[model samples]
Structure formats: C-alpha cells, structure tokens
Target chain A: MSQKRKLLVHIDALYRSALYLTKNENSADDLVQETYLKAFKSLQDDKEIRNVKAWLFRILMNTFINKYRKDKREPSLVDFDSVEAFHESIQEEVVAPSILDGESVLETLVDDDIKMALKALPDDFRMVILLSTVEGFSYKEISKIVNCPVGTVMSRIYRGRKMLKEKLAGYAQKYGFK
Target chain B: MNCNDVRKYLYAFLDDELDVEKNIEVLGHSNICCGCGRRMEKERLLQKRVRETVCEVKAPAYLEQMILKRTEEKPNFFISVVKKLMSERRLVSLAGIAAAIIMTVYFFAIPGNLKKDDFLYLAESKYHDYMMMPQLDLDIRSQDQEVIVEYLRKQTNSSIVLPEIRDNAKLIGAAMSEINGVKVSQVFYMHDGTPVSLMIICKPDSGSEDSKNVDFSGMKEILVDEKVVYYDDKGFCGHCKIMGWKEFGNEYVVVSKLNSDEMIKILKKA
Candidate 1:
C-alpha cells in the first residue's frame, strides 16, 4: 500500500478504536493521535501485520491499560477526571438539540450513557467487550490483538458484558438507551 | 439453552457471534422465553445507539483535524525510550523460554532413557495408586459391588479366578476400591518370576473396590500399569478392576503363588 493509503487506513482504524476505548469524542481523537505517533516510531514490523485494525486496537488497549488502568487501580473514580472532562467537552459540541433519529439524537441520549458505562468498566473488560461487540472482531482475532488465550478472550467478553449490563441496567431502563 | 448462559452472550448472540445452530437455539429460546427475546432486542438497540453516538457523530471536527496533523509526528526521545524498553522485554521473554525448555527437558524428556525395570516399577506403582482411588466418578461410593462382580463373573467366565492362582503368581484377593468415586470389586495379581503385577480395578467407583492400599510381602518389585488398571468397560476389564478393589476389612486376602494373568484367567472361570 502507498504511504497515503496506509495513512488513511491507519487514520480510520485509529479513529474507530480510539472512540471505542475512550468512549468520549475529544479523548478518542487524542488517543488516535497518540497511537499513530507510537505505532510509527515502533514501526519495525507493521509491514508483516495482516490485520492493521486489530494491531492498532492492541496498541490502543495497551495505551489504555498503561495510562488509565494504572491510575484507576485503587478504584478511585476521582482519577477519571481527565477522560470525564473530554466527555463533557464532546457533549458541548453535540448540544444543538439537533435531529431526533439521525445520529444526533442517537448521540445525545444513550451515547453519553453508553460511553460512561463502557469507560466505567475495568480496563481488561472494557477492551474485550468493545472489540468483540462494537468492532466485531472474532474470538481468534481478539486473542491475537490482546495476545491472550481464546478462552480468556471469550471469558472477558462474557463477564465484561454481564458486568456492563448490571451496571447499566438502571440507565438502560430509564433512558431507553437500548 | 440455560438462562444464565443465554444472558451471558445476549449481545454477541444478537450480533450473530454464535454459530447458526446456537443462534437458532437462542432465537427459539427467545421466542418461547420472553425474558431472552426482550434482552436480545435491548442489545440490538444498545449497539445501534453506540455506533451512532461513538462512531459517526461523537468526535469533534477540530479534534479530527488536529489528530490528523499530530499523528505524523514522532519525537526522537520517546522513540528511543520505547525502542530500549521493547528490546529489554524481548530479552526477558527469551530468558523465560530458555528456562522453560530446560525444566521440560529435565522432567518429561528424562523419562525416555529409563530402563524397562524402571518403567515396569513405575507403571505398577502408578497403576496401584490410580486403581486404589475413585478419580473420575464422584457417586460410585454407594454402588453395590455384588452386582458388578456378578457381571464380571458372567462376562469373563471366571477367567480372572483368584482362589486357584499359579505357583509363580501371588494372589491378593478381592477388596473394596473406588474408581472416580464409584465403588467396585478389586483384585491384585503379582507374578513372582517377573516383576509385573496386574491390578484389576473398577472405574467410576466400581463401588466394591474403593481405594485401599495393600502390602503382600516378598514379591521383589511390583510393577503396576496405572493407565491400564483402569476399567475398560467393553468386556471383562471392569471385572478385573472390581475384583482388584473388592477386599473386605482385613480378613480374606487369599494369597497364592500363581502369576497375575493366570489369576485373571481363574477369575474368568468363576
């Protein structure tokens, strides 16, 4: 692939993965930017990489784990200050009252709740569930990305969803988020 | 099909992550079970909301443009630090792999050079140890040993006769032992000429022969095959297993001088 095309693919994949990981608009943009910088500097073996999307995802997940999980290890939501700020920032941009159905309204109700819920999950769980559910990666693909056993991937996705549902039950029921 | 398992995969289940058969099962279950169907519907709505909010309209336009510009720049110091860290990690992984190979060679590979006597002795000890306990079945402790013994006598035609063993073999008559927690009959046969002792142990607890250790003095080395001592329910192997485990309190241990196979043949005769 040409550098331009590769860049585009990298950009698109980063955008999607960053969004999934951060669950907030502004922070996702920051994450994607950070991922590319890191990916390029360590760009020794990406040519041999088949699934660029998953590879980028692994980077994003690792970045999240390194940057986010460590900070939140004490289960202190107070440490979630920056990401929460970005969420608030994104909310400001999307507050036009906008159309009801066409992603705008969709953006308003469950999007904020969903992102918070996803970000609220434990690091390992948040990544696995998003990659499998939102990104539609296979168990095998996820195993490669996360570099865990397939059984472990399945377990994380299962338990992660269970935990997410439980945490989101009230919000899901009240807002009709889905 | 259980509710717990269904709820576990409701999102992926709705997304068609499961194979077709399972998907169909989920759908069928959902249709019949209102709870599951609604949960599936709820998941569908959730995904739609997520994609709409996160992917399409979530991020700001200025952030996208800013990200595009910043994505290309790599600071030299950061790159060098990352490179150093990665190399160190690689070295650590290599060290781990080398250690694992050494331990594996020390343990499993060491067994290859063992002499036949060593193998026989190991096999005998292993077999005796395995047959003595109920490893697999948890509910075999209460099973009637007599029923299994009768089955064995009929199947092998008493080919595993114990009372009339040969001069070359020592008979360690019927005892109680468990295979997988199931109790069954048991018998022990050891040949004096060779060091091999064949133990007849029942599986799933053969109830009659629950795990009991026996020591019949002066037979030199006793080699038991732990793997084979297990019940092979197809024919009379179970009988061997049961008889091997079917001894009572400490009393009736009719020892003889016949070999192990001869003892099994005698049990078949009964």
Candidate 2:
C-alpha cells in the first residue's frame, strides 16, 4: 500500500480528535479531509517524516488553529503567562481528594457525558488533554504538535484533567452514580 | 518527596514522561503513602476513561472512501485528450500538423458538456499542465515587462497589462493560449524562485455562441482597486490558488502557489 494509505491507520484517532475539536461531524470531516490533502501534498515533496502519527496530528492541530478556530470565533483569550500562573496555582492548591475513589466512574458515566465535559473545556486545555490523555502523546510529542513548550503542554494537561474530572464528578452527582 | 511534591509529579508519572529517578521517587512515595497511592489509582482511572471514551469513536465508514477519492491524483487532462484523439484513425495521421487545430476545435466547437464556470477551472488545469513541463516553452521569453506585454498584444491582438506584483517576482515570459475557443494570453513570472502564471481571457463577443461564454458570478467576490475580483482560495485541481476578475470585458486570472491574500495584494497594487 501507499504511504498515504498507511497513514489511514491513524484515521480513527485523528477523526475522534477532529470531531471533538469541531463539535460537528461535517466540520470534522472537512478538517480531516484537509489534513490528509496537506499530508499527501507534503509526501509529494519527498521529505522524510520520522513520526507519521505525530506529523499528521501536527497538521491537524495547525489546520484547526488557523482555519476552524477563526471560523468558529474560538478565541485563545488565555495567554501562556496566565496558563503558567494557573499551573503555579494548581501546585499550591489543595488536591480535591478522590473524586472517583474506588468507584469505577468510567463504567457509570455514559460516553455523551464524558464527551460533553471534554468538549466544554477551553480550546487550549481541550487540545493538550486530547493530545496527552486521550491520544497518549508524550509531553514532548504534544509540545511539538501544539507548537508550545513542554512546560506549557504539561500545565494544560494537568489543568485540563482536573477540570474534566470535576465536570465528570458533577455528572455523577446528577446521575446518582456512587 | 512530600505529598505536595508527589502530587505535582503525579500526572507526569502516569503519562510516563518523567525520568527514571523521578519515576522511582514518585512510585516509592505512592507505594508507602496511602493518600498518594489512592490518588495515583484515581488519576490512572481518569486517564483510562478519557482515552476509552474518545477511542470508541471510529471514523465513519464512508470517510475513508471520500478521503481516498479526493486525494487520488487527478488524471492528466492533456493525456486524456490525446488518447481520445489518437483513438480516431484519421486524427492520428494528421496529429502532428493539426495539434493547434485540434485544440481550437476541441475547446470551441464541441461545447463538451462543460459548465459555464468551467472556463476558470479549465484555465487552471492548463496552468497546471504548463508547470508540469520539464522546461517552459514560452513564445516570448524576456524579463522586460513591456516586451512581454507587446508580444501578448501582438499575438492576441488585444491590449494587456501585466499586474504588478509587490513582491520581487520578475516577469519571465509570456505565452498565447486559447480557452473555450476564446484567445487568451498567459504571462509568466518567477516569484521567490517559484513559477506563477497570469492568464488573461477576453470575454467572447455578444454574437458568440452560448458555449463560448465564461461565468464568474458564483465565485466569492472581493473589491480590489474598486474592481470586483473573484477568488477561489481553495485551490483548483492541484495546489494552485486561482483568482480571476473581469476588466473591460477581459477576464484576468492569476494562478500561483502564492496564497490568496498575497494574490489579492498583487491585484490591489495593479
């Protein structure tokens, strides 16, 4: 098979991320299509891509930031300085002990609830969390994908997970999940 | 590490992003400390849940087919035209002598079921084919703008002005071509070491057949220099962005790897 066809192995991963980012199936389809078009174009240049998955993800994120973000008017109002400060605050803040506890919250929580909570996150936080937690990209890999420092990626992932857990906990309360 | 320090490193540890020493320290602390150990499990579960939730979403069955279809290399139109022509016995014998005549008749006479808006797309395809050539075969090759303009005017028998690109791109040459049986002039330039083509196709006369008409009404319109210029930022065919506008009954299209904004700026400066 062609290299472009081989890249399809990551389609599920890319589409999931695209769906969450766009919050619409049609837009996600367009975004993924645009990503593959760009990838194919780059492949034509004969430049060797070392990590195809990470490279594809980078193109997806960049396209999202450039085209979709502007179209949706999703502003990056939270600057890196504030994000760093938020990380510092997270360090000092007391950890809310055991929201999940021994309870298998994942089993009780429906996919929509989890998806809704994740979708509600600010674009930056949602991006890092999706990259780090959901897609399992390493901190360094996410740093390159999102074009930010490793520290920034870590901060966003930390804060993003915290917010997601809190939201999930709220859902559990509403649904009477132990 | 204290409880606070261990909490800080918890995510990195779960993500396997920490160094070996830091990993051991976090692991050792979590092993002995009940609070840290429980927090570790909870966080791990959260990560797993998040991954599992999103991972359940597979791309739709049709998405793969759509992507493959869209990314598939478009067939070379010129080759298809030649194949169709070569399939006929009489055309094969006169192919060498009737190349230009075949082009004129194919574009103007046949109508070929092409939509009115296809005029621009056809021009874009011609530009794509030209760029694919191993070397440019320009009727007139010169860096002098007036010389190229004069050559096009003489070839097409129409006054034409080359749009002044604000960039350091130099006029390389000019070629005379026909689109939809309407005579057109193609001006070539080298911008930042990349070739750019500017095609000018004059609207056919009012008495001209309906098949020869070109349409720009459906394209996204922008006013540059107070003239309504339509642009297609989403490139046509290959990677070439196409921008066209009508002036004094002549349609101007600039096709290049340069983006829409830069192309617009060029039109504005013109």
Candidate 3:
C-alpha cells in the first residue's frame, strides 16, 4: 500500500481524539491535517515507524500541546512518588461487595453523558484514559506518547477512571443503579 | 494473590498489562473473591462505556481527501525551471519557448493565477461562501492578536499590525498566501459571528512597473491616522465591502460584508 493509504486507516481514530482534545470541529480538522502532514513528512526521512497508530497519535498529541494549547494553563504534573502513594491509598478503600450493581448504570447513561464526564476530567487524566480505555494503548505506549513514565501512565489511568466514575455517579443515582 | 495484592494491580490486570504470573494470580483470586470479581466487572463496564461513547466521532467525509490533496507533490524541478525561465530577463529567448509550451497546456495543467485578487477571492470564498482551498491552511491559529501578528510577520518577512475592531472581535488564525507571485500574509478574525479577512502585501520596489499600476480608481479615499485609506461601500465583489491602506511599505486590504463605517472604525483604531 502507498504510504498515504497506509496512514489513512488511522484518520478516524486520530480525528476522534482530536475532537475530544480540541472540542471544536474546525480545530479538530486542522489538528488532524497537521498530524498527517507531519507524519508524511517524517516518513520521507526514512524513519521506520513500528506502530503507525501510536506514532500518529504521538504526533497529534505533541502538535496539540505545542501549538493549540500553548496559551492554556498546563495540567499540574504529579510526581511519581506521589502517584505511587495515591495508588497505594486507593487500594486500601473498603471493597464494596455490591460494586457490580453499578455495571448496569453504564448502560443507562447515554453517549453524551459519558462524553461530558470524560470532558470533565483534567487534561492529564483525560488523555491517559482515552489512550488506555478507549484506544487500548498499553501503559508503556501511552507513557511514550505523553512523555512520562509507565508508572505515571498507570496512575493517571487509574485516577482518570475514578474521576469518570465519580462524574457519572449522579447519573447512576438518578437511575437508582448505585 | 490475596485481595489486597489483587486490588493494587486491579487496573493493570484489567488492562492486561500485568506479567503472566501476576495475571494468572489475579485471575485466580478474582474468580474466588466475590468483591474483587465485582470490582473487575465494574472496571470492565466503565472501559466499555467510555470506548463506545467516544467511538461515535468519525472523520468528516471530506477530511481524508483534504489531507491527501494538501500533501500532494508540489511543483517539481521541471516546473521550477520553466518558472525561472519565465522570470529571468536574460532568458528571454528560452522564456518564449517555455511560454509557448505553457500556453498549449495551460488550460488543463496550470493552477489558478497567483494574483492579489485571486488570493482575496479565496479568502472571501472561504469565509463567506464556505468554500475549501486544497492548498491553503492556517499556519497559526490563536485568539491572541500578538501571536497571530508575530507568526504572519515571520512568514511574510514584513511586520503586521492587527486592526482593533469594536465589539470584542477575536482573531481566529492567519495563513501565508501568494499575491502577485509574492508571498503575503492573511489574517482572519471574527466579529459578531461574521468573519473578517485582512490581507497584507508588501509594497513593491518604488520604481517597479507594478507599483505604477496600484489603482483604487473607483474606491473612495479617506484619511485615517494621516494615511490615505480607501473604502468601497459598494463591495468590490457582490457580497464583500473592501477597505485598504498603505503604510510602512506594506499594503493592507480588509475585506468583509461589514459596512464602510465599521470597517473604517477598525482601521482608525489600528
């Protein structure tokens, strides 16, 4: 397949992520365009990209951070030690035997509700959650994409999901599922 | 693995990132422990819901084609050689040969003219007519006037001053375009939900023949900041009113559907 044809397979994925990142259609379109253009240009340098999807995502993310989000306040960084401590603390929470009762609440909540909950997350957590839960990127892949350690990725994903669940808690309660 | 151990690695296990031994231990523990099992199930459900919700966003139909067209191979050396032959006075005989060949295939091969009005029409069509340009894209997108002006200045090798408009107008972005075969900068803004485009072109050398033809014959000239600013209330195109001025060796043209007074107010504020 041609380079462009090969790269085209990931456009939908990239576009979806760009939309979540930008929250505007035109900006998302521009972001994806820049990503693909940069990807194609880099491919000319004969760099072999082992995982094209992850590679494209990394470019999309870097472009977004450097160009689009330059003026926006950056998400505060969490130190590795603090994240590890937080993970340890979360594990000590009483394991509710009835957590499964909330499983059906996810079904009751529509796509928009889930989207709003996701958007409510901080940029750092939201990015990791999207990469891990939605795109199914490995913690290591996400670490490389976000330029952080694997431990940070793991912590962010855990915290991101926790935040998402908290945001949806009211909806879950509305449906009497939790 | 005990419940506490499994809980610590719960997300990693659910994400399938745990090592084989730990993965097997977590699976075994979750199967036997009811609470751990429920927590795993809840995590799985959350992941599924998040994925399904976000997967609904698909690229618009035109996006792929736009990407492909934008990355299409630019003019190669042969076209550059022909362009050079056309430009250099010393290559007059060669230019004659190239022009003849160009004319024969011009209808099908050459892109649209790189003239000043062509660029203006492009800006007008994109903002007003909602058209797309295969080649044109913003080099920088920012609401900050300073950022947009700085970026355009670098691209055009000329300083750019963004006009101040009333009613809290915001800068959208800026792009570099060719005007009269010279690189010029175009800045886009939005006011009351309407788009305004400002095209900045450096004035040609003082004695150049092109400078003599800079005509605003039908446009009404007015003084703003002691500059001879020109305005056309009856738009140059059917839908767009145009205001222009020359300062600091650059010609600035502001185009929009905005009335002459509003456009002039913006220029005066600059």
The top-ranked prediction according to TM-score is: 2
lDDT of 2 by residue, A1-178 (tens): 8887889889999999999988899999999999999998899999989999999999999999889867765454233223323334454456445346646665687878889999988777888888888888898899799875565566567777877887888888777765
* Each model's chain A TM-score: 0.63, 0.88, 0.86
Predicted structure with the largest DockQ when compared to the true one: 2
The estimated TM-scores of all candidates read 0.44, 0.55, 0.54
**C-alpha RMSD between model 1 and the true structure:** 19.8
Whole-model lDDT per candidate: 0.48, 0.68, 0.66
Per-model DockQ: 0.08, 0.20, 0.19
lDDT of candidate 2 at residue B83, scale 0 to 100 = 78
Chain B TM-score list for all models: 0.25, 0.42, 0.41
RMSD of 2: 16.8
lDDT of 3: 0.66
> lDDT tens string, model 2, B1-270?
988878878888999988999999999999999988987887787788788988899999999899989877675999788777778876856776688787787556544223223444444444434433325667789999779866765565555555555547677887676656666656677655455666656544423222222222222334456665544434322224445443432233333222234344334242
How accurate is chain B of model 1, given as a TM-score from 0 to 1? Answer: 0.25
**Candidate No. with top lDDT:** 2
TM-score of chain A for candidate 2? Answer: 0.88
**Could you tell me how far off, in angstroms, the CA of residue B165 lies in candidate 2 after the best superposition?**
48
- Model 3, residue B195: distance off in Å is 54
What lDDT does candidate 3 reach at residue B139?
72
